[model samples]
Target: MRNSIARRSLLKKTLTGLGCAAVMLLSPLSLQIAHAAAPEKDELKLGFIKLTDMAPLAIAYEKGYFEDEGLYVTLEAQANWKVLLDRVITGELDGAHMLAGQPLGATIGFGTKADVVTAFSMDLNGNGITVSNAVWEEMKKHVPMENGKPVHPIKADALKPVIEQYKAQGKPFNLGMVFPVSTHNYELRYWLAAGGINPGYYAPAKGDIAGTLSADALLSVTPPPQMPSTMEAGTIDGYCVGEPWNQQAVFKGIGVPVITDYEIWKNNPEKVFGVSKAWAEANPETHKRLIKALIRAAMWLDENNNANRQEAVDILSRPEYVGADAKVIANSMTGTFEYEKGDKREVPDFNVFFRYNATYPYYSDAIWYLTQMRRWGQVGEAKPDSWYFDVAKQVYLPEIYKSAAAELVAEGKAKAEDFPPASDDGFRAPTNEFIDGLTYDGRQPNAYINQFKIGLKPDSLL
Candidate 1:
């Protein structure tokens, strides 16, 4: 781990050449994540998309979290989410900052056939849907405004009238999401549907993965980094993406961010750190150590009312990290977010990586992804509630997270109170923070699914 940390640090220094800025901010006594111990693999490679949520992996490597555990890591930016998952599957990369559904979808053969697992969730609520300034102006008429601001939790209800205008005029209303199984895709769909807009569906059984079945707005996959270009090219009107792409839109003067997922559903789960299940089984101790470092990194990220966010924005701006311009990344990396060109608002929970147990690999989080898959017809078939649990168990490795947190507590690097009780069940208690105000109990997935007006029904199939 020491060698890996040292090597990653050197690589970051070479890539960033960031000068006194990095040196001045290097944390003292703040980087220790675990007791010095033997690491199974000294040199490792990890994969990531160029999104801001990838911060934990970057910070863990740059801050020497891997070294404290005696591991050396290489962070590589993948071209796309699928490529990142493939790299992990083919052992081209050791692990990746992954989509929460990538591991579960892979495990169930929904997209790619492989066994993937996640021990750590990377972040929460770093995603937003943005429209071009032109579109925002038109949609503004339908949106309810009060106190000189758009109402809280802006729904696609406002966008529906705008899309209708395009449709009535025989123009296409195109939108982009990062990937089919990405949280961005599901969140965008959920937002669009809550307002009576059909974003479309997938019918894997019918050999249609384009997800354009009976859609009003055409949804397509655009890599996170390409979202701005795609939108600016008039190829896509808007997109749902993670920072700094949303922030990039504002900086480029090309678009306006309407609402963040945090506003859609408070503190919603986002990305996860995923690896092939085979890799996890082959290096159990190493996997636990990796999760420990990530958990610590997440804790540092959200600590002290996000006091570290400014420094974090600078780190993410470095070419070796998120690599966007500092101002672009800082648009949201700091506590405030940019909506319209100048409507900046304070939204501290927009990128919660750790606080509120955000880093914990809760079974409920995995279950939510499965529900989305079914909702969009990616599942194609329905199963009992237990199937949701069984699938969630396959991808979300909370046991690994618990073991790592326990080790940290034993070493006094972390406290027992920082984690759920040792006897803790994997599921969180029921939650009702959804846009529709429907409660969700992970244990009763069937009942939860029934609450949705949109999506697959029991025993339904394409």
Candidate 2:
């Protein structure tokens, strides 16, 4: 009887210990389930170019936003925009920091015939055009001056004389932008053509994609991070690129940033977060969660009248991030922009993220890029405005954004007052802030295109 009791007691103790062990092992997981944390697709690899707008990714990782949702993310720096896009399409990267026009261009089959989409816009107004000191010295002659300072929103007409000089010398006045399909390319071309500089054309019908057809100033491709290097090598006279590259030029004292894209088109959309359609489809919840983190990061970047800008600039300067000098990053980030040495100007909108409804991907913004592509013959055949609408729908995912935004409100991570009302339309109010005095209404895109003195209109395709 004694042996029986001892054995039973021992068995009872062992079983109790096993139950306790099970409870301990499963408690954390049960809490994860109870909270409905992010899924088994927790391990991720995201890519970014070395630019300030890549801040969301950096901030999310640094602040453990990804971890809060039970994700372990690896952020990689891409070689170039093309390589980055290719990686996203081929599933080499789960997603990436993409040019505003990349998904639009890719979806329309202009460059790579991939079905890419963006639900999150990374930033706004973070790019600028910079010229070598030598080029600027000559261009300064034509630039309008006030109080001994060059009047800003300086038109490319100022550079026309310099290009003429280059032409007279039997040399091409070369410039650089990150990609041919990039907003920098379009903005640079728009600014030049607006100034009667003839940025030239792309005659893909003739197998010429150099975009220098009938060109006054020849624009070529230079990777964003390499813009300063190529210009410093004297390979190109000037370049249009995003920050801190423009600021990088200033720091090296090799080039001077002439104007920012904010001044190009005030509060314009810049970079976006792009994922393959398949990834978004299979991982809808994870995708929404990712957007939530990014949206919070965007808000944080712009909160308190941009009080966090210095902190963000420091984050961007880290060697693993943008890897540029902090001063270079601050030239634009700190809300004061330096043109020539000691000729600093206050530019409050140099790097907008959450403010001005920037993170929302407007259908009209997508359409504007489409119009530029069509204007330059990227879209070879003329289609109705409905085609523009349909293509814009495919590329920009405002519906997905609405879902994520609505969820953020429901979860109380963000206030209902922070975003547009549930009945809010995708279009921003008509903007008259363009440098050239053109008004843009997202609803009337084609009419706005028609207003342009240059560029292909509805009737001018042939």
Candidate 3:
């Protein structure tokens, strides 16, 4: 790995030197426009997990968007989310493709206390909940069928009876999520709780971070890439994870994906491009340039009505990136998702990168994650709505995102219409698109938390 990184560095420097020399001769005005500001740190290493949503980083590197911005970036796949976050905090990694909740979780001292911030929201709605074959068989019995096919958006209601049976049989029902603060964890818990199953709670104040207090189904962290095999090994009955892993389960015939996060909440934000607060402070220009490159990559991913998805799948399938089979990655990337075997369905928004202003780091997106953290007892005490807003503003740097996006629009690389309006505030309009049909107004996070039937209510202590 070290040798390969060295070679990549050498090649990037050689190519960048040659490209700069050629561009300098064309026009001084053009050169001034192109070279943003000799990057504070041109050569940098960014980290990612081997999930399909890491496409922005991969696409940025592969399409030379990084080079276009005078940034020499090496995309290194990390062992897992924790390692990836730790590296970014410790300055071993300049930045990383991170879970949207990671920065919030880290900043609030959920797992690791660090001042991590994100200027780029990576993608939206790219995860699914999968159950092992045995659980699927049992769930199939309860699931509503239409024309001999299981209905769409298979609710956790179908999995409730299975958990009951596991308890009756003296078997501990186990489920997996990528990380404690991951959207997968919250989405899985949300689905399970909506169906009247107690997924569990956290009591950090009591020094019990296990998150399995009085639970019907035991939830644990499993790395994204190992989710399928972990289930195959009988360690977890089901899992909520991002794409390719859920699809891998279908291909391996070990499990069946029941529903996607998109079905749970429409166009939900997933991952972000994250850096330490200190890193962003020191490399403001570099950070803006990085976001600029990522914005372009995101537009490319969803451009022309997803005409480039096939190419993205191919690029992601390479060993250096996602390393999954092209067919498995394509199962969800190309505007469709496979549920049960041969149950291919059109889910055009499954892996959104740029459409619907997905890349913008909305403050509402940050607040939603904070609400989930509080709902599950990660935040031991209740916080005011003002506190939520302050934390969201602190962690999600939309000004940086807006600056990068405005530059893109000014350069004619992107359209003003493609972005959120200049007068728009950082919050999206209140949405009630969740599966349970609960309305979420970022301005009223505490009220939203109080509405959840499960989870810790306001003034309720774990």
Candidate 4:
């Protein structure tokens, strides 16, 4: 088996090198435009958790997109988010897949004070909140039904009665999210708060980062892959996690996914490809090539309306990658999601990678995460709108993303129309697509934070 694997690996690398050579020979002008600068560092080790959104990294590695830009990347599966971030900070890993909020959170000294930054948004709308079988049984009683099946976008309102029952019985209602600064934590909080449940706050200023102060539902950290087994062991009643784990619950008959982040906030930013600011500055050419490779991978994932998702599922199922059954990964990756055991529904944008310009590192996306941090008290205090914008601009580097997209366009690997325009200003148009129906304008982040009913109020501290 070792010899066979080595032979195949050698063959794959040889073919990849030949492919790059062919591209250069066929289009010398394109090569000149794309590779104006040789990568500052050619070999890299990138980190990721075993989730589907890591697909871009996997696709780039597997599809030779990385080598196409003179990058040799080794994608490593991280034990958890903290370990992943720590490794990146220490320079043990060149970069890694990260939560959309991670770079911003680190920059603002929320969890760990580090100058992390991201030019590539890995994916969008790939997470769901799941409940244990018992919780789902009780929640079903309150959920609206259509034709004897549970209605879609099941709000946390249905979950409220169940929590009340737990409270009346004096049983502690516990839930799990991947990390405090993760999209999972914020989405779970957003959903609960929208339904009048206090998911609680983080008074990091007081050294109480537990985030469960006066909470109806106490949410703690559970790594993505462990979400299913951890809930099955009865340690957590439910969890909000990214793909394969949520579907794994359904496959194991242990839990039911209630609502995806897509319902909580449509096309919400999920993960990002992040590196330290020092690494990016020292290796600017290599950084752009990394982003260029990721951009190509994302385009392929969403190309032709996700025509390549099944193949992506196959790639992700490898033991070195997500290591989940293809069936479980496909449950969400193939344009549909399973709620109940058999209640699969069409949700084409469930795991978007490239569509809707998903790879663009928008400052509005960064500000939204910051708003969540402030709302949950992780930021500890209110600041001027200028502070939010400055933090966002510092962490989410749109200029790097645009430079990469420009390279791809020049090389004919992607189109000029495939990226945000030069005048995008890094903010998405103001949107009210949240579950609570509150408007959020990135330009007016403090105003957006004040509109929340269950979060920290203006000038309030825990």
Tell me which residue pairs clash in candidate 1.
1-70, 1-71, 2-70, 4-72
Query: Which tens-of-lDDT digit does each residue in 287-382 have in candidate 3?
Result: 999999999999999999999999999999999999999999999999999999999999999999999999999999999999999999999998
**Model 1, residue 25: what's the lDDT?**
63
lDDT score for residue 104 of model 4: 88
- The TM-score leader among the candidates is 3
Q: Per-residue lDDT tens digits of candidate 2, residues 1-462?
A: 234334544644664578656546666645444357446476678999999889999888777666655456778899899999999999999999999889988887767888998888888888889999999999999999999989888998898888889989999999999897898999998888778787877766667778777788888999888999899899999999988898788878899999888887988888899998888888887787788788888888889998998998898898778999898899888898888878888998888888877788778888878888877767766667888888888888877888888877766678777776777666678888876878877676677778877666755543
Point out where model 4 deviates above 4 Å. 1-27, 30-35
Candidate 1 or 3, higher lDDT? 3
Clashes of each: 4, 0, 0, 0
Error of 4 at 412 (Å): 1.0
Off by over 4 Å in 3: 1-24, 34-36
Clashes of 3: 0
Model 3 lDDT-worst window of ten: 28-37
Candidate 3, 403: how far from true, in Å?
A: 0.8
What is the C-alpha lDDT profile of model 1 across 11-69, one tens digit per residue?
A: 65563586556546656543333224445676789998888999998788778787667
- RMSD to true structure for each model, in Å: 5.7, 8.4, 2.0, 2.7
lDDT for model 1, please.
0.85
Candidate 4: Cα lDDT at 38: 70
